[model samples]
Target: MTALIEAESVKRYYSNASWLQRLLFLGGSEIQAVDGVTLRIEKGEIVGLVGESGCGKTTLGWLLAGLEQPTEGAVRFKGRSLGNIDAETRKKVQLLFQYPRESLNPRHNVRTILSYPIRKMGHTATADITARIHSLLEAVGLSARYADRYSFQLSGGELQRVALARTLALEPEFIVCDEPTSAVDMNVKVQILKLLSDISREKGISLLFISHDLSAVRFIADRICVMYLGKIVEQAPAQQLFDHPCHPYTMALLDAIADIDPNAIRKASLHGQPPSPMAPPAGCRFHPRCAYTEQVGTICWERGPALQPLSTDHLVRCFLYPEVSQDPDRKQ
Candidate 1:
């Protein structure tokens, strides 16, 4: 099966410019927001990206959605490069940002928000456009009465639902959900997840769900990928990953969610906070904090590890797991 969206060695860097740059020629350092992230989302599949706050999961999501161009490599949709796709074709992939309250226009009513996307269908009667918006509201579990309501009039969950309604209005083939449930309460979070899962299955729309909540991702994603310091550290079938995490970082994430399953792993604290991407560690980005890294030698401290297959459908990047290392003489 062909991938609905493919990102190859994608990297995104943001340069910092100080006030002195306006006067002098010196430029500030570049922040490595995303570094060498390659991923594929198969048609009709939901892939979850879970990671620390600054690990570039959201940046990768936006890169795959074509909202931002990579500093290197390319993002392709259905074998066609993102740059070659026209506006109409580009609409096939959409991005739902982390916060709906900020993502949605505060001034626009629900009718105006949804109707904006239908305008791409070319000029249509105002009544027909409104009718379409009403259907979208209903589809997102909102009543037609919502059409007259402004974003401020709704709660966080309600606003997110309205945002989802606007997204569905475009009839997109793929959606990148960046922590869509983060702002809502626990009860509402489950409802939102189910709604998204149901909508994906019903519409056959593939989804890239990015979140820090492993349990939620495992519940909603067909496959799960773990990111660390701007790189994907591990990936596998959701159940497989939750059952047997390969990378130390993946294990730490699982351990962090100890409340979910008492027997999963003891509530262990990680060594320290992740290093800044602007000046990442010399070797494996997680080496400074990974307990297993000490089991290995300089190999884990001198060079970064590439993602290697652990099983037929599982991949992990780490030096402790020497069986998957490409370097034949790599330190044990």
Candidate 2:
């Protein structure tokens, strides 16, 4: 069966130098933001994409949402190319920006903000638009009284809820939530997560939740994908990944989190900064930071390991599991 959304070996690159500069051997670099990534999101499932900053999480989200085109591959919605989708189908995919204040227009009030998408999309009657605006606000836990308030007048949490209401107004089938809770307080973050999860369940909407917060991802995601630099290092069910993380990067991230035992030693085993995307290492991008690289010898430095299946659903891109048999059904 086809997934609701699929990114097939997509790559998005940005060149800092012009054609003339590159020809002259001048200063130029290519940023491999999203390199050779293949991901699938089933309908109504929340897939959390967790990684450090500059790991291309946002870029991949944009590509998946059809807000940005991939340089090499294609993002498909239900087996159809995003570019070939009609306007109505396009509306089914939406992006929720990380910063709500910046994404919302200060000049417009909450009602106007929510009404614009509705009006432009298909709602022609003022009465229907007004009803939808209020309903969306209510759905996000906002009162109808907030309808007249502008973005500047709202608090950070309120602004985020308003932003979510604006998105919900479109009745999208899928949403790319890019760090939705990063700008809000802890309590508000919980509210946003609950609201998102509830909406996805009630409306059968698929979501790609991008964040560095492992705890949050564990709470809301059915599956988790760990990215490093520009490539996915590991992917598995949320519980499986947290319980038995296969990749060194995933282990380091889990170890770095605060443990319940205050006396327990919990220093992250992984060390060193990530290599630059523009000049990634010759072999595995994470070889320099992986503790097990020495045990693997030059194999870690001379050849990039493919994303191999450790179990039926768990996949890790590393050389530590050379003995594991390749499963054709779960091949990366």
Candidate 3:
């Protein structure tokens, strides 16, 4: 399948200071929310982006959704540049925020909420608009009867379904789902995920599923990208990443999830929090916390490793592998 969305060396930075205080502070440090990241999503495929909090996952999603433009690179959709697309064309891509309740307008009834997008898209007839609203509600597992009820009357899951219905009203070809299941209960989460999967398969909609939940990503995504400090450390097929993670950071994360063996000695966990993106480490950003840093040496500290091909599709950015095999421990 052709790539429906592609980001090349995308970067986004924020200079932090409230508008009221900006005049007092002459120079505030810039936060590198997303730095030099590249990714591609094929039509009808689900690509999961997994990382810890403050790792730039949400920023990347925003860039792809066109909610925020990249500071550096470009986001392309269906072979056309996002920067060049007209407003109508851009509407083909939608973003579903993490919290459905907070995202919805409290004052509007569900019918008004769902119909708002349709009306904005310029469908004037009341009969046509009502039919579209009903179809969208039914598609997202909500009844048309609930359309007259306000957001406060709905449960968390129901609110989320309404949000989904609203998004579907635009008939978007691609969506950036930023932690869509994070706020709901497990049962509700399962329902949402299943609904998203069914919609994608049936309609051929592409998805960028961003979440901190590795297990959830494994079930939803065909390919996975592991990110650290605004960079993609590893990209592989979902099963390959879970079965054999190459980057030290990726290994540490997987180890953190596994049940600890009672009889075995406890190994040291990854040390130190991620370095500030304002002044990220000179070499490999993860070397400071990596247990395998002994093999990294001066080169790993002096230069960053590029994403090297490990297999047909899997790629990693660490010195332990053959193309970047400067690590003495891996050599031995």
Model 3 lDDT tens row, 1-332: 54799998888988876675688776577888898888989888889999889999999999999889899889999888898898888989999999998989999998889787999788879998999888899999987898798989998889888998899888899999999999999999999999998998989989999999887888889899999999999999999999988888888787776576756543545666888888888888787787777875666777777877798889898877767544443221
User: Residue-pair clashes per candidate, as listed?
Assistant: 0, 0, 0
- Looking at candidate 1, the ten consecutive residues that score lowest on lDDT are 323-332
lDDT of each: 0.87, 0.90, 0.86
- Candidate 2 lDDT, tens digit per residue, 51-170? 999999999999999988999889999899997899888988999999999999989988888888889778889898888888888999988999999988999989989988888877
Q: Give lDDT: candidate 2, residue 42.
A: 98
lDDT of 1 by residue, 256-317 (tens): 77575556546335877789999999888888888776578888878888888877889888
TM-score of each: 0.92, 0.94, 0.90
Query: Over 4 Å off in model 2, which ranges?
Result: 22-27, 260-263, 323-332
How does candidate 1 score on lDDT? 0.87
RMSD of each: 3.1, 2.3, 4.3
Best prediction by lDDT:
2
TM-score of 3: 0.90
Q: Which stretches of candidate 1 lie over 4 Å from their true place?
A: 17-27, 260-268, 323-332
Worst 10 residues of 2 by lDDT: 323-332
